[model samples]
Target: MTEGVDPRELSDEDLFRELQHLHETRTDTLLHGSDDALERHTSRTQELEEEYLRRYPERDVDPDRLRSGARRRG
Candidate 1:
């Protein structure tokens, strides 16, 4: 079993740091990690991201990322 801290238990700064690190390594993990490692990474990412959304329900949305923005660009 991979013992780990719950994302909810982390302070905001620590949570953000963990999330950042995971995201930074995502592509490499996807391409190079073993199946179990990739699975663990995916599960951990979900835990952290879900916690982040729960913490900030009204998180900012960038207009440039909206569907309308993509339409305009096209």
Candidate 2:
């Protein structure tokens, strides 16, 4: 449905919203959708994610989510 919109043209708020929507539907699309549908979802997800990263290159990192953090916790 959102395939018609380009990630580059979206605002920061809209891009994040689209990313959330895509992620929410990802499981169903992967398990049940057709190959064509899955491909489109994957492509759109990547485009939006890349744009988000481009805009927020300095996003805060959560060290507890990293590999080293896991080892420490264990």
The weakest ten consecutive residues by lDDT in model 1 span 1-10
In order of listing, the candidates' clash counts read 0, 0
| Candidate 1 whole-model C-alpha lDDT, 0 to 1 | 0.94
User: Candidate 2 lDDT, tens digit per residue, 1-74?
Assistant: 55668878998889889999999999999999999999999998999999999999999999999999999999
In model 1, the clashing pairs are none
Query: lDDT of candidate 2?
Result: 0.91
Return the top candidate by lDDT: 1
Q: Each candidate: RMSD to true structure? A: 1.0, 1.5
Name the runs in model 1 displaced over 4 angstroms. Answer: none
